[model samples]
Target: MLTEVKNQIKVVFLSIKYSVMRELLNRFTFISNVIFMMLNNASMIIQWLVLFSLRENMGGYTFKEVLLLWGIASSTFGFSRFFFYKAFSLSSIINEGKLDSYIVQPKNILISIITSDISVSALGDLLYGYIMLVFYGLSIKSFLLFTYFIITGGIIIAAISVILNSLSFWFGNTDVIAETGNHLMTNFATYPDGIFKGIAKALLFTLIPVGISNYIPVHVIVNFDLNLFLINTTVCIFLIYFAFITFYTGLKRYSSSNLMSSKI
Candidate 1:
């Protein structure tokens, strides 16, 4: 079992390494993509600055807390995009019958599919996240917690992506549902959870899951809580397990297009 796990980890790293290398072949383009993405994200800070100038708080989020929220939001987005951007297209891959190549691979099909591509621009989001962390209040503990949040939060995003996109198996095409869910997660993540109330807040926590992805992490990191950490991490683990179950269960329903394609 240990060896199997080790091999799987090896495959994951190797996949990411090669994908990154392929993108790095054009170093100038790669750097430009990262820079532009960071700049785009940074531009939004201007709006917040203007708003905070007018009043003390927006939805109970101080400027610092909002910055923290952005850090968590961007990091999770970056982590998922940089590492598993292909998950975003699960709908197309399924609906268009593009899983043939992945199905033939010896490595786990989901892993193979997700790690097949890398997003250079997303590196910016990841970097911006770390940068936000520094502005929020950098400490050994805070840094560790922030990193933890990115990984677990990224997984939550990916798992949710898989869960929503996996619906393509039952329904002919679920691209709209998948895209809507993605937007909801990304958009809602940037704001303070305190702003959302009643049904909206409930949806974020349960249906959309932006709460587990960013809100809970931000809140806990701002003020660490042992029990919350355990509970949050536990939910993330469950999501990971559920994502795999969902994909494979849907895989069983996959009708191969037999479309000839190459992975190299």
Candidate 2:
């Protein structure tokens, strides 16, 4: 068992090393991703500043609270784009017959498909998010609660990305769905989930649960409530496991172009 665990660790490290070298060789793509990410982050920051300046608080959250949420959200978003940008782009692989070569390779096809593209722009978001989280984290008294929220929040973020990427197997044209999901997550992560009411809150907590992922959990963590914190943490883990199971199930029926029949 220990030997198997060590082997898995070696595989993960090898994967990381391969990805780093590939990016080094593809400097042009890396540079482009960074430049585009900077522009995207600058735009988001500008909007956040404008909104904060215009109101004392948007939906009961002060500027600081909004910043905290953005920090958590952006950090998760950056991590997802950095790691799963390849998975999120599975539609292109299916369309271009990239999966043909992937299937023949001995490595895990899904991992290869996911690692093919890395978004370097996410670094900018991560940098700024770290700044925000540190600033807020220092002011907050309950360090343990804050830590729990951050960890669970990360799980939720990863769950969202994996769940959407898994859908590509069925939809085939999942770019639209992925884009909409990105928008919803970004918006939901930037504010307090309490702003939502009734069915809206339920939707945010369930189907498009970006609300519960970051904001709601953070809220409970700040209040130092043990029950809510545990519940949120449990939900985050459930979502993560659920995403993996769902994707694996879908993979069972994942057919390639070779399986398609020619029209008469």
Candidate 3:
């Protein structure tokens, strides 16, 4: 047990180190990211202002919860963009005959494709989200929950991205699908899932899992439920594995069409 624990710690540390390296590498990319970051930050503030203007609270949540949700959403958005930007454009990568290049590489094609197009501008979302989280009275327990929230959100986002990308294996072009799916996930992440009802809420929890990002967990935090937390955590873990399996299954279908057409 001790050995397993130590190994897990090492793995976590390595993951963190690798992520930091990727972020550092992103610093030297194009200047356009600065403008994007600025706009994203401004948008967060504007969203809060707009929400507060109508009423101090929407649903059962206050302006503070709204702000916190925005922060978490933006941060998750940025994190996804930074780490998996390539996943967002997998359809194009497959359609443009660029996936063949990845196939020739020694490393894992999916990881390489994903890491190749990191978006630093999303970090702006992360920064602003964290700041908003702090300003809205964050406690230690909340902080722990927030970490779990972000990690789970990343997993679900990755799973959804892979599922969307897998479409490229069979379909010629899936840009519209990818874009629409991304938009919905972003929308779900930004608002409390409780605001959604009936089929909408059901879809968010099952098909999207965006509700797990903030809604269910936030509710658990507010109401203090250990069972809910455990269930959600387990679900996130399951989703992560589910995503990997989907990607690998899609990989089996990825063939080198002619000399150029392929998804690596």
Best by TM-score: 1
Order the candidates by TM-score, highest first: 1, 3, 2
lDDT of 2: 0.66
RMSD of each: 1.3, 5.1, 4.6
Residue pairs whose backbone atoms clash in candidate 2: 87-114
Question: Candidate 3, after superposition: displacement of residue 95 in Å?
Answer: 2.8
Model 3 residue 55 lDDT?
82
Worst 10 residues of 2 by lDDT: 255-264
Clashing pairs in 3: 71-129
Query: What are the per-residue Cα lDDT tens digits for candidate 1 across 128-204?
Result: 99999999999999899999989999989988888889899999788799888889889889988888899999998
Q: For this target, which candidate reaches the highest lDDT against the unseen true structure?
A: 1
Q: In terms of TM-score, how similar is model 3 to the real structure?
A: 0.78
Residues 156-260 of candidate 3: C-alpha lDDT, one tens digit per residue: 676677678768777868878878888888877777665689998888878777777667666765677887787778877886677667666767777654553
lDDT of 1 at 192: 82
TM-score-better candidate, 2 vs 3: 3
The parts of candidate 2 lying over 4 Å away from their true place are 1-6, 25-43, 46-54, 94-116, 137-155, 257-264
TM-score of 2: 0.76
Ordered from best to worst lDDT, the candidate numbers read: 1, 3, 2
